[model samples]
Target: MKRTLTTFIATLALIALGAGARPAGAAGVTNAVAAAGTTNIVASSDGKFTPSTIVMHVGETTTLHLTSSGGVHGLVSNRLHIPLTRIQPGKAVNVAVTPSKAGTYVLPCAIFCGLNHANMKLTVIVKQ
Candidate 1:
């Protein structure tokens, strides 16, 4: 009886840990694509930026509407000319950006949220 109970508990613990484990290369994977002009970005306590990628044309202005669905977060990109922007729950912050060059810019979360913060990033693709 004792061995059976211990085995059951061990199996349960393994299942619980596996449930939170992500597949290899699954970090930062996003299927969402943001259009130009106006894009809405959502931050969460899970340390993720919704619509992880944004596509824009060079010389064209785009406004990023930043808001948090869970915890506080922030981002800043000097190459993209974006200033330090903070995102918090119950509030919205708008940032206007016009990419002069065409390239891919990866902006990581400026503020640390939690264990998954390193995987939190937004990819901006500027096209000529």
Candidate 2:
């Protein structure tokens, strides 16, 4: 029974992974408009950032493709003062951020993920 349960859970996770964004007919946008140098961020229930840290030049734009594998989570940057809160499950939210100064910015999770929420952190480095 335990093995059966594990197999079921693995199947469920696969289903969630398949259900990323809505169909194009539902989202209305036929094509995704991502600007140049925009990093694609993929977040999961592992409390980790796919790229973890990124390097960008001053005034460089990047779009984050925030995705949830199972439950809901959010992206909140304390150093950059940007927050996207209350994200839903099986959803993908996109945001565009540009660095203006040469320094390091800390990015954190806004919504409640789990006990190790504090460790769900990342850094974005900007250079000249």
Candidate 3:
């Protein structure tokens, strides 16, 4: 009876751990417009930015809704005029950007996340 109980407890522990595990390379764009001019961007602990590429019009302001799925992250850009922003697991950070020039801007993760941190970047394409 004791052996059976121990096995049952072990199984439960394994299941609990698996529940929190996320698959690698499972990131995708979450660019659905939440509002009239808002774009959703999600960051994950796996070191990825969802909707890694976005398109914006020059002279038009767009709001980026940033959130983290598994870990704390940060973002900042001098060209885009975005301030240092913190993205937490359960909190949302909004950044408004208006591009004055037409070009492709790469915004990398401001904070080091993990092994895949170096590849984490968001590409913004601005057009007239």
Candidate 4:
């Protein structure tokens, strides 16, 4: 009887340790999660998202600052993903996006900027 009790106790401890050792996200998004509005993403000198890409876990919101050194750009997404708002050249536009799904969403340029107008894109990394 004592031997059986000892074995049971050891098994429980092993199980507990294994569960604690596991990560939060099944996909392994272990980095610091950037909560909503934690940081603002800005467009690079070439009128592109500086970091260009963003990583976020499920159930989090974030703010993006799309700025252009020259020319006017708007946040254009499936729902006005262009610049957050209409800002003059050299100005920054703040846009908030809440990704309910785990996938890549594009932030296109709302305005007709010509030539490379279709190149504006933002990658939202959602951890499922």
lDDT of 4 by residue, 26-127 (tens): 113213344546544444335564456777655565665444544665655563233346534445556666666777666666565556667765676676
Clashes per model (N, Cα, C within 3 A): 0, 1, 1, 10
Q: What is each predicted model's overall lDDT from 0 to 1?
A: 0.82, 0.64, 0.83, 0.56
Q: What's the distance in Å from true for residue 87, model 2?
A: 4.0
Once superposed on the true structure, which residue ranges of model 2 sit more than 4 Å away at CA?
1-35, 78-81
Lowest lDDT sum, 10 consecutive residues, model 1, at 22-31
Find the number of clashing residue pairs for candidate 4.
Answer: 10
Off by over 4 Å in 1: 1-36
Write down the TM-score for model 4.
0.53
What digit string (tens of lDDT, one per residue) describes model 3 on residues 1-128?
99999999999999977754532212234544456788888998888888789889999999998888878888898998989898887577789999999999999999888888898899999999
* Best-first order by lDDT: 3, 1, 2, 4
TM-score of each: 0.72, 0.64, 0.74, 0.53
Which ten-residue region of model 3 has the weakest summed lDDT?
20-29
Between candidates 2 and 3, the TM-score winner: 3
TM-score of 1: 0.72
User: What is the model-wide C-alpha lDDT for candidate 1?
Assistant: 0.82
> Model 2 over residues 1-128: C-alpha lDDT tens digits?
99999999999988876664453232333124434655555555777665678777777677666665445677776455466655454466777677677898777767778866677776788888
Model 2 scores worst on lDDT over the 10 consecutive residues at 23-32
